[model samples]
Target: MYLIAGLQPPMDMRLFLHGFQDFFPSKAWQRTPVLYLPLVAFGRMTPMAWEELDQSLYTLHLPTPVTLRHTGFDVTLKRNRIILEATMEASVIDHLSVKIRNLAQRAGVSATRSLLPSGIPLADITDVDPSVCNLWLATHRHRFASTEEVCEFTVFKTGKNRENTFQEVMSDYQFADLFTPPSELL
Candidate 1:
């Protein structure tokens, strides 16, 4: 199943930190809230590349899309929502329902006071049509003269029509980062 979660801004990173644990309770025993890389990979990362990866993982205010791996899920955070692809089985869906509820309840704690439960509630989530992204790419790929132009369009359109402003800063830097080929980042 594909899912989309519409999140609002001024976000507290701890919400996600705790939400990750909530989603995979079994992994809670091993939780360190840290992602480890092999020494060889760590040594090979250029300062800039390391900084880019660090920002993607640690920053809560990022406007560009980024994917972070949790215990059993790969969550892609975009300007408007968090996206995930998972099984549509009844058990998995039930687990999701419980996890989101647990996370929402935790959001009310003083430590996560900046977060709004409504912003992360089930009401804001929807089952996604996976092909929408593919259809979007197919329709728009030919419209731009260059990849950079396509990226610029992507950045500019993010969260612009939403009732709430999520991004405080928009920059040319995001245009390049968002569309850079994955191979180039490694």
Candidate 2:
């Protein structure tokens, strides 16, 4: 968690931050770790942009701000650009990221990285760009212990019961080898 205060920006920007803090107090913001999406956009932003994002997230049935353990978006407006910093769990990040990308696209902002949406075709797992493959592995890392487990899950998502070439897939994509943490850390 990081503070948004410095010399402060123009009056309108200050007002926007003030209003935002009024709703989602600074204490809560500082206590939690913030996860940032790979998207960046330039241009003036308003309270309406935040409201629209809130309304769109509401449609997704996510928990309210009172429960900050799950997910939320914090905007960091610098110069003439704004970055949507997301705080989320691995389980929901993929879904939220796709939605955020769509919203950014509508606003003419391009995402630096693209994530594979759930239910992607099995063939795409091998065909997608390497960066996309890495991002996919990253977003799913928390739920899986090893590449084999991820391969199993991916096959399951594709409506298949098994994958005989787990090694081949894992090697080709370089999801890399899993690391076993020190026992004390665990």
Candidate 3:
């Protein structure tokens, strides 16, 4: 199952912190693989006010980017939408669903305070063609020109299935420590 959320600007560290700070103690968790594309592509695909937010927000320094490793899950930014692509594993899908829901809830709270015009929603979950994931992996692999795109690319360590916690799922997928600060600014 794949879950997606359309987000516009003002989407800085605060928004993410609102959604996931409790679960992810550090900014490292935001380092999940991301693909950024024009906002128009997303607005054309969905009925969202993608153009309303300040475009400068996208330029803000986000957390470090994790290299694409052909992991079963991916988070893509097409215009304003954050597309979460994952395999059909129940635990994996469920964990991601909760994450998205948390984001939506937090976004809603912020919206009420007029932090932004509107909040992002957990748009939908659908069955995507396997080729979509394959294409993403292939494109990222080609773009980064890295042959060592495996799940264990990070340095974080974790135990296996300890109390069936979210950390356990992250550990199993080798995503326990997704963020790595770059030694030099590119």
Top-scoring candidate (TM-score): 2
- Candidate 2 weakest lDDT stretch, 10 residues: 149-158
> lDDT by residue for model 3 over 1-186, one digit each (tens)?
111222211224224323332343233333222221111111111113222222212222323222222223344443443434321112232233233334333433222111110122211112334465455446543221111211221011122311111111111112224355466944
User: For each candidate, how many residue pairs have backbone atoms clashing (under 3 Å)?
Assistant: 1, 0, 1
Task: Count backbone overlaps in model 2.
Answer: 0
Report the Cα lDDT for residue 89, model 1. Answer: 13
TM-score of 1: 0.17
lDDT (Cα, 0-100) at 108 in candidate 2: 43
Q: Candidate 2 or 3, higher TM-score?
A: 2
Q: What does candidate 1's lDDT look like per residue over 18-41, in tens digits?
A: 444354323212332221110001
Q: Candidate 2 on 1-186: residue-level lDDT in tens?
A: 000100112234334333433443223232112111221121233445533533433333222111012133333433443222323234443544454446544644332233332221112122234464345346533431111111001000111211211211110111112353467986
Model 1 misses residue 93 by how many Å?
26
TM-score of each: 0.17, 0.22, 0.20
What clash pairs does model 3 have?
A: 39-79
